[model samples]
Target: MAKVKGEIVINSERCKGCELCVPVCQQQTIAMSDKLNSKGYHYAMSINDECNGCINCALVCPDGVISVYRVKLKDAAVA
Candidate 1:
């Protein structure tokens, strides 16, 4: 079986800083930025590479600011 890895992209300008996606993430990869966006809000950010492509954050985001990408890594023996 292959292992799944994921990446999360966020449009800081589009984000409203609602913090809706923060708690929904099971991996706790999402966080609020220390800096503010152009809209003067703390945008969402992926704090680490632990994302599993769950899409929970994307689904909960009202502004559609989050994007998730997943890749599969084959076993080392197979590689």
Candidate 2:
């Protein structure tokens, strides 16, 4: 079976920007965004094309703001 690629989403509102998820991810997929949230703190955001579906970001996020969405596969045969 082939592994499918996915993307991880982080919610800016709930994030405290504690820099907690930065060291947890082995792939270094998550990075602090320049934009600040409503709380005026720089929140962590995933770099483009960096996530590898390891779910490390989701697991480490204290605010439960991370979400993983798998890419849909195209059907090889016409229905």
Candidate 3:
């Protein structure tokens, strides 16, 4: 099986800083941004490129602010 990587996108403007997405991410890829959004809240941001596309964050996000994409690692052998 090929190794999989994930890309996570968060709509910071739409994020309400609910912190729901953080705990669900086992990879700890998501975090609250130091900067504030237009709504004056610390929005969610991708802190690292370690997401595995589990979609747990998306499922827990009440505002639908998260999107996840899965990619097969180029060097990984496929069977």
Candidate 1 per-residue lDDT, tens place, 1-79, comes to 3378788999999999999999999889999999999889999999987888989999999999898998876687336
lDDT-superior candidate, 2 or 3: 3
Winner of 1 and 3 under TM-score? 1
lDDT of each residue in 1-79, candidate 2, tens digit only: 3244568888888888988888987668788989999999899988876555778778878889889776644555211
Error of 3 at 57 (Å): 0.4
How accurate locally, in lDDT, is each candidate? 0.90, 0.78, 0.89
- Lowest-scoring 10 consecutive residues by lDDT in candidate 2? 70-79
The segments of candidate 1 whose C-alpha lies over 4 angstroms from its true place after superposition are 77-79
> Candidate 3's residue-wise lDDT over 1-79, tens digit each?
4288888889999999999988989999988999999999899999887788889999999999888899877763433
True-vs-predicted CA distance for residue 63, candidate 3, Å? 0.5
Cα displacement (Å) at residue 50, model 1: 0.4
* Local lDDT at 70 for model 3: 96
Point to the candidate with the largest lDDT.
1
For each candidate, C-alpha RMSD in Å? 2.4, 4.1, 2.6
Considering lDDT, which of the candidate structures 1 and 2 is the better prediction for this target? Answer: 1
Q: State in Å the error of residue 20, model 3.
A: 0.4
